[model samples]
Target: MNQLKKPVIVAFTIITCLFSFSSCKKDSNNNSVDTDDPASADPTLTLVWSDEFNGSTIDTTKWNFEVNGDGGGNGEAQYYTARSTNAAIKDGKLVITARKENYSGKSYTSARLTTQNKAAYTYGRVEARIQLPTGRGMWPAFWMLSAKTPLEWPHDGEIDIMEAVGYRPDTTFSNIHCTAVGYGDLLPVPDYGRTYHVYATDWTADSLKFYVDDRLIVSYANAHLADATAAYNQWPFNHNFFMILNVAVGGAWGGINGIDDTIFPQAMSVDWVRVYQRK
Candidate 1:
């Protein structure tokens, strides 16, 4: 998710480049990198953190529920709440539900969970298994944002590992936002609303790779890393970033076709979240 606004709908174009294996380089590298290659499982990576969602309740020690009705800066219709009815652990999965209700001056209610102050990472492999919600109004996402206080969006950077709007049930989007530029791509993902699939991102100082069911879909290499005139706005992903999971309703992108009020009580079920770092 882009912080200030939803991503611009444009032709899907993957910004790709090559970098040295020894250091982060710019697009000038001579080696031709294939962005479509499946990122191989690294044996050196060890699972350093994980949430199996096996508990009876949301683990407050690792997550914080954001309560607000600020429209998520996207003209969203749902009011985020911290109630168990909005988010709960059931059947070994963290279920985030969006329901039709008049609450806090909003016509819909939902949940937004974050690992803001609880857990953050600089660079690693983060992944989650989730079964999404269907219908015309649902907007479910697994994303990350800078952990810096007094957040400054776009400049601080955002990584949208997975985003699926209810109307586009067979397509999922992956994007990265920065002050320099924002790039996104769409991929075909069948039965995403009814079946579980793994959404993952491998992040490093040099690049970001997005995967669905272990198949690489989008790969972005840092374009300003080796440039002498580059500024922080070109790449602000070096610092710590925390995770966010939410189900938004009638947002800028999700509400483009208007919402289907009949599909209330939609839920996004997250089976597990795991983070890995090189050991």
Candidate 2:
């Protein structure tokens, strides 16, 4: 009787151990987020500047819209509009929407907002919490261009903090463009449309660090920033740059998707945009 009782006790103990191990394994996949409200998120960054977009309308005082005629960007077929139809503030967020409607000869419509005359920064961490738009022919971006460019693009340079095309919803890219290097795009992830992620850049005298959701992706050092090599033209980023936000439809880069009229008024929603200077 004693031996039989001992075997039963061992069997029970083994079963309990297996159950606990299974529970731990299940918890590893439950990537739970905090229960805190977005508005209540702690400010861990130094607020050097921002466009909260809190007003009833786009605070034109801090931003201006670009209205590109039908042949925008040199024959690109997008009639960029500044109207509220293209961009608006609703429920405490900035929405840049694009549609496949004909206002005139142009077949597609969208918005492009800029801070060229409003804000300029030489070195700082620029961040935006954004979610991408879905469907082909949709192109959304957060970027910067030379604030004081007398000539044209490529000469002044371009910095793409984040750019995504609906056709390639799986990937978002960050790239630097100059006359010498031409242009380069990289794959940061496979699927960006599934969730809201933080797209950010920390630019300093030393280098620029690219991050997504506090996770570091790549760091370009000052040497690379100042590199005079023909492949990496340094003139573009050495000067000040202003910010731009937009959602383009059926353009050179976006038009590759043909057109999806069914997904009219697709929005690139931005939760927040913040800039921080070093302490």
Estimate the TM-score of every prediction: 0.87, 0.76
Cα RMSD (Å) between model 1 and the true structure? 9.9
Badly placed stretches (over 4 Å) of model 1 are: 8-42, 224-231
Identify the leading candidate in terms of TM-score: 1
Candidate 1 structure, TM-score to reference: 0.87
Residue-level lDDT of model 2, residues 1-279, one tens digit each, is: 000011011110011113444311111122222221121133543556666555578888778898876444534456879888889998667988887778767877888888987888888788787878888877788988888757457666667787776676676766665665433345556546655677888788666666667666555554454346542455456668888898766655666657677887788887667777665
Instruction: Score residue 156 of candidate 1 by CA lDDT.
Output: 88
lDDT of each: 0.82, 0.65
Considering only N, C-alpha and C atoms within 3 Å, which residue pairs clash in candidate 1? none
Global CA lDDT of candidate 2, please? 0.65
Residue 229, model 1: lDDT of 37
lDDT of 2 at 209: 67
